[model samples]
Target: MTDLTPPAKRPANPRFSSGPCAKIPGFSLDHLADAPLGRSHRAAIGKAKLKEAIDLTREILGVPADYRIGIVPASDTGAVEMAMWSLLGARPVEMLAWESFGEGWVTDVVKQLKLDAKVQVAPYGQIVDFTTVDFDRDVVFTWNGTTSGCRLPTGDAIPASRAGLTICDATSAAFAMDLPWDKLDVTTFSWQKVLGGEGAHGMLILSPRAVERLETYTPAWPLPKIFRLTSKGKLIEGIFVGETINTPSMLAVEDYLVALKWAKSVGGLQGLVNRATANAKVVWEFCAANPWIANLAETADIASTTSVCLKFTDPRITDGETFAKAVAKRLEKAGVAFDVGAYRDAPPGLRIWCGSTVETSDVQALMPWIAHAFDAEIASLAAAA
Candidate 1:
């Protein structure tokens, strides 16, 4: 029997949006008081802040010493476009897409770049078989599909001795999952996803091979100043350090630094991963116990721990899209959740962010509200019938 009573308890923090996700627990605007407002990003203090962000990121993610990490303009999308424009024409390209973002990359490579790239895509809840992928060609893929709630379990499928570069979009996966730096020649992420920091800035990490590609090959098309990573066939060392191509939000940079500090206080990479894993487990367990709701991912191993997607599985759901939206709406109106709706391009469902910044207790509180919302929606459906 479905319980229509609203859950007595509600999540303390109702932010479950996948991007611009919830801030670190106990976050405060006052934390950004030290931000160098009205100062040039090229100023000494600003550069020091930027360098600290890079160093802390490397320390937390365990990126190799030889790999160059840069703070770039725009977010993860810009980082990806920069890499594609700067490095892809050097070799045969293979684009693997499982979700909307990945598909966007494929479109750019084929339609925009006019590259005769090999494209492989899987449905929303499933991932492409890595065994079928030819790593000999430069490979592009997202480590985790934020929209589809699917992720690559490990880098075991990629060969370490591959001739081509592996460019990975790890926006939602970085700081929350284990990334194999050796297998990835280029990796991109933004501070807004897992870290719950301000957006408009992207982090670009490059292996030695990626730098070599930048120095050795020039693309067929004209490179935008923002996208260019090399000058006179030499890699731009300044970008890899603290110098950015454009002015950045010093306030945003400070917020990221604070988030990074909080991350270290908890336990660094392992701690963040554990927090996200625990938060996702709450939802996974709820789905396991409820027949009406189920994880969108086809398999548990590939299921995302960050953007945990879910769908209604009840037989009574005639209009899946409408029903899902109604449920999400009820939860929002009840003040139990907000921005829990699925991505615009994804199938109708809820996308609850279970990133490191989210507390497990809040996720537990959310589960009962979800049940209440589902039951109320079902009752409304029956009444209409």
Candidate 2:
């Protein structure tokens, strides 16, 4: 092992948990004073702010004018549930998963809904074959596997003339990747991801075809009031504009507005993607030089730029879980990083957030700390042996 001493340069800010990520560069509660607190979300002022969040999301993300984007309850999960409950039974379903979040959706469809669905799965650090997927059937998949660090490159696998809808969980992908609007019938993401805003509210974007499905077909199962998207055989246009299905957190709404404004100030989506790309490159080069670590995703082309997961390659370590946890503990005790450990269901490894909210300089500063922690762990193991 190299020097076990800690690195002198620490990340200026070490808030790198995947979700509820770092806030915009200079985020402050001062920016949220005019949040219209203690006011009804249905009130004109509160509605205006909510509408502003949706509008800014459309402009910043370049969502098509015809697509309907709404702020819904329960973050990304709620949004996905709304889509699945409202739309799945109308057609034969095909669900694809490579990580925890994606698999969770598949469970909901097959187990809960009991729908006629075909489930395709890939282990952690890998992705299912999109080419083998039949676009003629409705498909649900995660655009970015946050826990696995694998992502769908483009919408090319989806045929343009397909008869089905593509529902994608893009929680970690939004604001950092280009989503093919034309290819997706429904897309869901939370503000707490790449944009680093508040949680419990999701931005659900629906294509024209998805709207038609909602208006034309109804599911055989019962849908709770929260999951209902259409009313009286028509899409609820008010929800698309500013009126939410239920009470919303105005404080969270205002914070998301600040994030969207920051995104615009930083040259919009492209700039966000570039910053994430640069951050991922740091880990890429670091892994190249360090033989002990390798990216969890084997396919370089499909590797994620947002949640960059890495696995230990050093053969000396017999207990992967214990070794990885020890290294993560060292980093946390040193206050150099926190919550960088792999997800509970994922393979034991490190999962780093490299979204736009994360700075390249901070990631750069974090590199040495990680190496130092690794060496210290290895040496401790050797001494114990």
Candidate 3:
């Protein structure tokens, strides 16, 4: 096979960063030419754009009438923290953790909430034993672990008749996977993931049960005005409307609108799923042919269709940390991909973002370059040995 190095000065292609994935493939500055750049977010026109974004997201995701969708503070992390702070004190909580993002919530529950809690955790590449968890307690988990590239097969594993709330950090899984909306009490994600939009905001969806919990139960910790979901113990109606607790960037709101429009034009949620599935398959096929490479995730069914985790099989670099760093650097130097590094909190393995915004053609181009990088790195290691 031929080495896949580009001629010197070639521009980046197949960029595989996990957060801000490729921007709508052919996206250009022309798309933003007519955007209102200098308008106040509180203006009638800006509010109208925000309202449209909320409606489009609701329609695209098939969100139920009983739920409340709000554009909230920060990105995915902020939305999750708002939910945790605003909604937790009512029930005994169980936090499920398998990767960095999941573990972040666990830290918030134990260290920040100081709640009476239990943690169910597993190392990178492994999943928590679902059978061992009690559904009667409030549960927090990531539908897809972007860092580890592992995901729960489905929300079906969650007990149907559980009395406590189910809160999910679905930033990476939102548009790319099938979410059992009936089972989720609270869900949070960001536009920067599957939609490939500007960050700085998060989307928080709350089921009726969650709203009821907020109305009846109050958290002990002091909540910022922005995190409060209720006005004098009554759910806020304006949040679901065009009203926001704090000002939001109009530009980001416009980007989200553009992304939602693209998502709908491509056939809505199912189309997004198809794009992610196709991109991930390209990586899977490459892994199957490469003897020295394998997915860090164990099973095909459990592996993420959004972020594909991979690692080298070289025995000499048995330390996952060493191998992951070497391979990532080689790929970066070759210009095959960028920010294709392992999560600092996750076990060492490359995490490639394969969200819907990333193109399958880009992934196809990336695979051969990956093989070339691996061969070059391995040879260098042997030479040093």
Candidate 4:
């Protein structure tokens, strides 16, 4: 007896991809008109633009004055690889993973780097116990599991006084959550995440301790030019000061600048956090009101505000993967949502992005459509049977 009729209300913006998320509410190509086209990145104009991006990032993120922020190649993956190749292998390492991306890092460390790292992992909806971890060893973890829709509630478990560094992949969490900067020695993110900027650029923020590690420790293996952070046993200061190791996409840089400006106008980090929190609340409320669906995150505290994952729990459902895909397809076909399917490696469910660029009203509008799609899919399954 479920109402299968489509919802008249539809989200104006249907981009809900966790990465390369929805653009700012009023984003326009005109914002990038000032991008310096056809100019060398090393030129004065390019360097100035890049420096402004760095300065604004520090101001918005409230990064410490002694920390270093650099624009690196690739996206978040590149930034993470660069940090691992350059800074790890200096000490005993422990890798924590609860999602696909984190598992990839473990593979890189265990198989590629051959670091003999101790790896602790949990199921998709769960997180490893932070208290049981040894902070004395170099620790690498994701602040938010992009694929799992689970996140660390706080950085309190990390000790203030530890012998090792804490490297964090915070691509989806930055700008949308409270990041404990003091506890993180190396944090990496990409332009395409919360800000909805273009890709091919990564932000690498390093604490003083990370810099000391870079300057003193050298990996046993030779590093590629792009991964190298130190030269002649000294941290490459220019890399942190607008001098990139390789050429960059000025257009993408301009897009990031525009997004950063938008972030500031929305009250910077706290503002961005509020928007994401509110957006996710809409979906959380929807799940609470509906008995057939629920959050994929086992606990509310560990649930992600940016990539809010969901699972259908109807007893009538059969073949979870196909049912989830059918529901997502119905929503997509109805033009109410896009890219709402769960990650392939994750539990069968939906992953709706509720990042800062997404509006609360749009999320409110999309929830009804999800119910509509679910009802239609369920009826179709019954007919097929």
Candidate 5:
């Protein structure tokens, strides 16, 4: 029942997981030869390397001159929690969720912190209505819902003069999409995403308003040492300048520096966006021609460009979960692709990474393999019938 006639070509690289995505096309361990291995992070050389990573990040991301950026512990989650615990209790909160990660943040606000929060949530594959949110109440949400394959269509929902702060989880969105920095008060992302760097640390970007919030308000709950951004009623300016609270992985830092350098070499943020947009077009065109396969996202405008998700619409597939898993397993077994399965919390479908680090050519090459796998699954269903 399998399709023995394989495609003429295969994806050059088959490492498309949602996170820790494909590395730069020419990436090699040889590039990290200069990493300060075994050197004390507090040493002058170690400090200089860390500062270099920070400077390049700011320059490439085009962060505002006044905003503060810091390399924090954990991944994006730590950055988000630090902002939440340090600054949230000062005002009433609005928790909006459309996917697993968003739901986790909602749980933290309403149940754990027990704040006076209004929860607005939507089912997977759909977005919540931004109109229902009260801007006067601090709003927390995921800029890109990675699991459900949806993203914020625009920042128009947030007013510039709004009284409350906007905290966003942009781990999967940052480099691949345009973030309205003026509209966001606190934004968090990790290197494991679009940059194709290691996931040893997270990046936290704070607007002037976010800094003011930290200076003016402190949560009643206890703050862990790692989450502390202020000391004795004043902001710790050193952390914002590469003085990390804990020892960081110099190896990971070197890897991230390599990624940043590559990003600049490719024409900065717009170039990265173009790569992701072009890669996602391949999935869009495939869905258009193949009636059986369709995007899981409900709306085209809000669809994810990085983690492209698709569901099967054919009548022959009796069990969506079983059939989708079979298709992904077949692709993985053939070595044409790997980890293309839908996220555990998402709908039964296929999830492909189309971030900047993933080559459009690789995505184009993988299409035939996908079709072969789908056709093979269809044949299996017919045989079973």
Candidate 6:
């Protein structure tokens, strides 16, 4: 583990990382002490808290009354995996991959499950041609690819009469965007993204059709205890009602409950979206003023309001990888932000999470430091030149 030693001087402004982003303003560990500790997850108190989180998720999203929501394992990754393993084997599947996370789903199809699947892929800065996906086949996509900062505007591209289902990994888009539930059959996200809670729990929401599929079609492979979606060919009712198949972190559950309460107080889902949009606009305006900085995803309309990605335009720093790493290192050293580097699989850029939990003023304060970080690296490169 890295040293937790206090720095000689602390950053005047708080840092903003993409995932495990900033927490709700004024949040503290003191609140966590009151969380129902040492309580059995199956106990009435634990169940009541977990149930509250589930209920709040539905209320904030305005999910259809017929849909079922449950807490799952491994955060967003686990929620998506659960849907894939439990619901995909019986159908002809169409997988759309635009960035690293979407590509992960493709890997799950080809390598892990080894299913016969048709894959449509797009480069990092662009979205897949929505018209190309055969709605007749089971469709899988990421609502917002966290790495690329690109997303599909809506599922209107999905044909209305198609017999297939749409499964979406909406890890980064959940509460920040209007998810068209009529078109999505399975939706997955995590508390750590828009919710700003600790990780290790995934939220899975299934449409009526998804539930039907789980009850009717069984995967040929033997599922591990955690991946099983049904019991004796019947969808387990209690799991969706705060009963988990395996043990989960009660502390994490409590944190999620607190997040849900905060979400409700801030005008629920719409408020969350507003906060992210407002924060992203600050970064976008900064990019407009600084000629050296531009968005990796071209088109402001398509830009992500949650993860604002920035690319440097300096030809002198042609190797975006080197420039981005150095800038991120400098920012970390300054204690202005940590983990601001582009994802390894992505082209070099700064990816900042302008999520609901982040304060717009903090983003405003941090922008100058981002410029300083870039300037320091560029100056060093020039000295070497």
What TM-score, computed on C-alpha atoms, does each candidate reach? Answer: 0.99, 0.99, 0.95, 0.99, 0.98, 0.95
Going through the candidates in the order shown, the clash numbers are: 0, 0, 0, 0, 0, 0
Q: Which residue pairs collide in model 4, if any?
A: none
Tell me the tens digit of each residue's lDDT in model 3 across 130-193: 8888889999999899899999888777877889899999999998898999989999999888
Give the per-residue Cα lDDT of candidate 1 at 180. 94
Per-candidate local distance difference test: 0.95, 0.93, 0.84, 0.94, 0.90, 0.85
Per-residue lDDT over 1-385 for candidate 5, one digit per residue giving the tens place of the 0 to 100 score: 4555879899989887898788887999999988999999889888888889888988988889899999999989999888888889898999999999999999898888889799899988888888788889899999888888898888998999899999999999998999999999999999899998898699999999999989888789999999999998888988888889888999999999999999988889999999999999999999999999998888899899998989999998889999999999998998978899999988999999999999999999999888888998888778788
**Candidate 2, residues 332-355: lDDT per residue as tens digits?**
999988899998998998999999
Better of 3 and 5 by lDDT: 5
By lDDT, the best candidate is 1
Model 3 scores a TM of 0.95
Clashing pairs in 3: none
Task: lDDT for model 6, please.
Answer: 0.85
Residues 1-385 of candidate 1 have per-residue lDDT tens digits of: 6667777888999999999999999999999999999999999999999999999999999999999999999999999999999999888999999999999999999999999999999999999999999999999999999999999999999999899999999999999999999999999999999999999999999999999889999899999899989989999899988899999999999999999999999999999999999999999999999988999999999999999999999999999899889888988998889999999899889999999999999999999998888888888888899
lDDT of 3: 0.84
TM-score for candidate 2:
0.99
Query: How far is 376's C-alpha from truth in model 2 (Å)?
Result: 0.1
In the predicted model 6, the residue pairs found to clash are: none
For residue 230, give model 6's deviation from the true position in Å. 1.0
What are the per-residue Cα lDDT tens digits for candidate 6 across 175-289?
8998999889999999888888888889899999899999999888878888787889899888898998777788888777788888889999889989999999999999999
